[model samples]
Target chain A: MRNELDQQLASAASEAQAAAQTLDGSAVAPSRNEPDTAHPSASVSPQAPAEERPRHRCVELGRAVVITSGKGGVGKTTVTANLGTALADAGKRVVVVDADVGLRNLDVVMGLENRIRKHSLDVIEGHASLDEALVRDRVRKMLALLPAAQNRDKDEIAPEAMRALVAELQERFDFVLIDCPAGIEQGFRNAVAGAQEAIIVTTPEVSAVRDADRVAGLLSGAIAPKLILNRIRPQLVKRGSMLNVDDVLDILRLELIGVVPDDKDVIVATNRGAPVVDIAGSETGAAFRRIAARMLGEALPIPALSDRSPWFARMFASLPFGKRSSTRGS
Target chain B: MMDANVFVVTSGKGGVGKTTTTANIGAALAKLGKQVVLVDADIGLRNLDLVLGLEKRIVYDVVDVIEGRCQPRQALIKDKRIAGLYLLPAAQTKEKESVSESQMEHMTHALAGQFDAVLIDCPAGIEHGFRNAIAGASQAVVVTMPEVAAIRDADRILGMLGSRRARVLINRIRPEMVKSGDMLSVDDVREILGREILGIVPDDEEIIDATNRGQPVVLDGARRLGAVYSTIGRRLLGEDIPYVELPNDGLWLQLRKMMAGLR
Candidate 1:
């Protein structure tokens, strides 16, 4: 009975694989033609001179950014989900890829885990197509997720394969945000392989800062990464108990892209399997929106913790060392 | 004679007190009359010598011994304060790739034959450096803080340790925070990592001062942290000592209990 069951399961898997391959073969071929009519830039390709091909291709490709932290649970996935949702809310097509492999959480955090039909490993292993692997977000039409295989190890998908997948995704989406696994290992290298830019996420702690410094040094040769300081408690900073934004900047020496204050709402939203940006009246959601705007090259005033404090506290905040200027653009 | 045990002190995330733990535990073990040798496996960032207050006496390092430039005995620095405590310093100028796994394994085995315990200070991250550090050890001690990030990395490291005689050393735990549910409790960490508890070291500012002064906390004798490390040493020696309990954070603890009761 066991042998018969195993045989049936194997045959069913093979049948599904064959069906997926057929679907993928058609899906991959027609996407290019489908985009030609939808995108005006593609129409310019036939009319453009041969000399402008390289420049046109560069304009057509989207930016690929990897969010990473050498320390785990410093909110790399949370930042990726919020940033992707915020970008999608701004009407930009976005795809967030979970590159953490065995410890996949981006899909759950994005509230699209149950909808996963195909995973990144399936696409890389030729069992599924990119379209089959990409799960469109239920609430947000502009956002999609390329979920990682939960059961697969980090070595299942090589860096070269991830690069190819990211390159293909870059041609279709406006922003490709890859959520990197913690630690500078095979998974981290794979996450950063195809990305043009990097965002280092860290919390206001000595351990996180040191790991971020190490990660920054490793990523220095490949991409000049921007730093996102997450989980900052203003009250603790004021008490001089925690490392402030400037202290972190002094250690990391990277462009400060965003500062996300610690809020209970973030944990609540994460527990509910929704990005904090989807929660109404979330301060962290507003922070993520500001980060997205800053990424788009918008010059907005940095939100101040003192603005939410009492009037008496604002007077003490005016001290030179207490106040921080808005992070200037790179 | 019983076989000498080897333990590798590692935490996947940096700055979680791996080197400090190694130094203090070595000193504590030596204080307990066990011959101990602490190996610094963080080649590029040599900190074990500095933590042991033997930085200036380092004429030879682990790489020098591994490359046959000097005898392992010559590279080992004896601590004058703690009898039978020695440190095999790492080469600051050399990268992690300078030392191979086989060389480290052979060196550790040779040292284990002479000492009662060999503690290898593994570098942060699960890279080549980490692999080289753990290759020699028969046991592993994963140091982590009470924060979610450190616990997550500890879980990953524990997963990598995989069937090795590994114990979780919860370091820098702020009891007040844990009591108030602001920080992860020992129960929470135990549940997540599912490892046997070695000990919990309280978050103490004196540890930083002790590190800066090149004095291991175990040498202080008077500090609570010194007692904590000594207790950890006793536990490693197969003694059953209960963890140190901190004073409650008063009304916050009551409020949290009431909140739990409501739930």
Candidate 2:
């Protein structure tokens, strides 16, 4: 069974490599799982032995954090694109991985859709080197993307393959943010396998929260999953119709890392092939930047979002329920 | 003459009414005097059993049948309220990997041979569960809401359907929102998807109540949504039917659709 899957992935990878060569005319190594010595940067080749590479450049292993929401269309891909951009803007080497095979959206959301010549399947199946598969951001020098295959399903890559791939990526980038596909199935399992920490994204809807609660319960391992409440309409919360941050926290019982309000600019920015984080004066963009800073160990205050509420309500929200040790591990 | 007896109801995004569509369509087909069996292929996150009010009666699920713990007939749960309707529930505790594509194929083939229609409720995302669900089916019912993200996911799903007969079912459309241009209209969805729309269900609150009561909206007497699902079933059975008019389909929108059709 394993050999059949490996063979299928190998053939798919070669097809991708051929497509990439046709598109870019870059001289790619025709051999499987071998170092691309034809490239100018052979020293930095991902297939190079550890002793030949410069070890002093990476001070510490990068953090592999999986951004997942159990429910679909709840802004998991959007959060991943914006957060990775924010981290790259803060001078951190970040690689956002689209782990949603067959439904890959991270590439399009980050406007790197056309640049994907090779994908995660190619690297995992050893048809392309890790360096060959990584797509650099158009403007950001530090941010990169490891896009998923649009043709293959999630079961094509195993959890062990994903864990090893993330470990290899950790040696190069400062952060590896995996954009997990929705659902609590093999796709979810594969995305969470490589991460030491997780960021659970959810909206205030009952279905999204229910799925989030189920996912939080699933991630009961060493990783204490943090929450990023996205698309909160404060007006609905004030009207007692929608669940507020406190209500979601009460149900999820997770540490709150970021609270982003609903902004139409996010939609406009996404459809334009640019993340909201890169847009000027976007409140959602500012929220992502703050979350990135907080991820980097900054003790930024979590915004309560309900600014129109009375001062006493905001005070009570901040006392115990708002933020929970967000600055612990950097 | 087993011509496309199995249909997999799927949407790339979750909570977009895949299970609800499967249950209602199965019930509607059964009500049409056809032997219909609804298979919940979601595995670990099974909801079709609950939607059909057959949760307590599930002794053997799809996983049990595929894994050879029980025969396919032994695992089938017959609905007491509706004659000729049955359910093959998914295992609540087993992950999707417990059932492989070939196993699902054999199970679905066996079930399809005995029933007039086999409606599979596919799990969200195009992964192991999706592959397993679509393996035994000859047709797919792609469900989606009128939202941008849902439409995008549905478009992706359409791309992945690959030679399997597929149709789009737009669910949970609010006519007022479509009139006010707050939501995508049926014409907008039809244009974006560029596929044959099987049916369009209005945004109804009573469907939720009916679902909470462990009954499909098709079984509820007072809701027009049930008739829409029945119309969808008739269309699936190769009937020429006009799309149901929504509660308030504005004349201007109809004129716009007419103009678009001309173009």
Candidate 3:
């Protein structure tokens, strides 16, 4: 019975994608100066090439970072979606790649599920060119998505194929954020193959932290991975129930990139397939923006979302030797 | 003689008690006079050895057998308490890419020839490790919590299993929460997943205590926790046993029904 269902699903997924305007640039050719006919209504001025645009900070041409977590359901996709939006909102060209084949969630999270005409597997299998497979975001032209096929296995894309794909993406975007699948397997290796940096996301739990530690060890020799502690409830930490940021950092010993508080607004945003970072007044949105600033080399101070420290702690901070948590910058 | 049964226990989301279910079910089947071998297919993050309390006894692991460093039987660690139970531990220092699906299939086939039942503990995620774990098994025992995220992943895995005679085992169900409508009911989970029920195991602190001591609850001789898993084992053996009644089902359920009637 399931075989019939599986085959039906596979056949539906294998249907040919609708034709999209071929991108103006390719991996080998530097033709980004040409305006993209794809997004005729994009807000950004098509005449200004992203590479030649002036910025407050002279950001690197292309930065590829894979956001990964060893444990499943710990908000890797959420972080990738929001952080990419935040970066693109900051005037950086960002392309978020959903590298989790067969379980693609970034498209749904980013509210671009219907806009996905082609995916990374199509590029790898030679069914679509790199330019033809790209899906540009409607609201933010600077933000684009490279979705993963829903019916294929992770092993279908080899590490070399992934490296080439990421390299091609790196040429066009200022920030290439790859949404890595959970577990340190073929999917992980493929996601990390072309990336120069990694962001390990984990929740404030023993099991999630332990898995993060294992992933940290694996990534030690290649890249010094940064940490993003997600779903932290300050009330639980203040009540001595959940693990504090310091406790998690003390265990994993990785540099903290971002600490996102548990916010109900995130659920609402996700349900609508919109990124929380794009929603106004969302604490998780603010957190992702801060993380994006830090990624852009801004030494922004990470404020404690809801810190109600004791009197002595405040007094200690006033004493020159002790520093307040809010004063600490990454 | 009937064919040797090979069951791969999997959950798409981590920390959903796939390892615990694998340990308990393998021990329960072993206690039923069947020669059972539990294979830990999670290569890098191996925990079945620690869960079975056989970490010290594992001189050779599954990777070692696949890489030709040791014979298949040489890597099988015998259980101290159960006579017919064995374990093939995963290598702690290796990665998941170390073994291919064909290698895993060959190893499990060899073990099936010698054992009456072979149960594999699969890693989380539908990646290479998940593919390798299911490659060797004829049947799948998918473990999941009654949460939305876990159920969604389990549904994806069930879809991928593609008619391999799969069954769902809902673990860590809190009956009080279910009664209070704070959690999904067993019927809700069954309807959402649309799979055959192996059994439902309640949230019990005793299971945690047993796990910490490297003791499976099924071997404890206790009635509540042990019986829950052993009944699933009996069901696996093709016996028609009724599902275990949760602790609060007697009076609490009757009270709830009476309250609904009053309303």
> In TM-score terms, which candidate is top?
2
TM-score of the first chain alone, every candidate: 0.77, 0.77, 0.76
Superposed on all Cα atoms, model 1 deviates from the true structure by an RMSD in Å of: 10.9
Comparing candidate 1 with candidate 3, which one achieves the higher lDDT? 3
lDDT of 3 by residue, A158-254 (tens): 9999989888777556688999987888888899998999999998754566578888887889998999999888876675445567656656778
lDDT of 2 by residue, A1-330 (tens): 322222222323333344335322453343222223443232333333334433234334679999987777789989999989877665456789999988887887888888988999998888987767888778675678999998788888889999999988876666899999988877888999999999999987654665677788789775899999998877766654465676677557889999998886775676567889877888899899889878877688997744332322332243222233222111
Q: Supply the DockQ value of model 3.
A: 0.20
lDDT of 1 by residue, A1-330 (tens): 212211222223333333324422321111121134334443222233323222234335778999998766678888999999877665456789999786677887777878999999999998988777888777666678999886667777788999999998887676899999866667888999999999999986654565677778778988999989998878766655565676667456789989998886765576467788767788898889889878866676775443221321232233222234334221
DockQ of all models, two decimals each: 0.11, 0.20, 0.20
Write candidate 3's Cα lDDT for B10-29 as tens digits: 98877678888999999998
Superior by DockQ: candidate 1 or candidate 2: 2
Please report the candidate that would top DockQ against the real structure. 2
Clashing residue pairs, candidate 1? none
Which candidate's lDDT is highest?
A: 2
Error of 3 at A95 (Å): 2.3
Quote model 3's TM-score.
0.70
How does each model score on TM-score?
0.69, 0.72, 0.70
Q: How many angstroms is residue A1 displaced in model 3 relative to the true structure, after the best TM-score fit?
A: 44
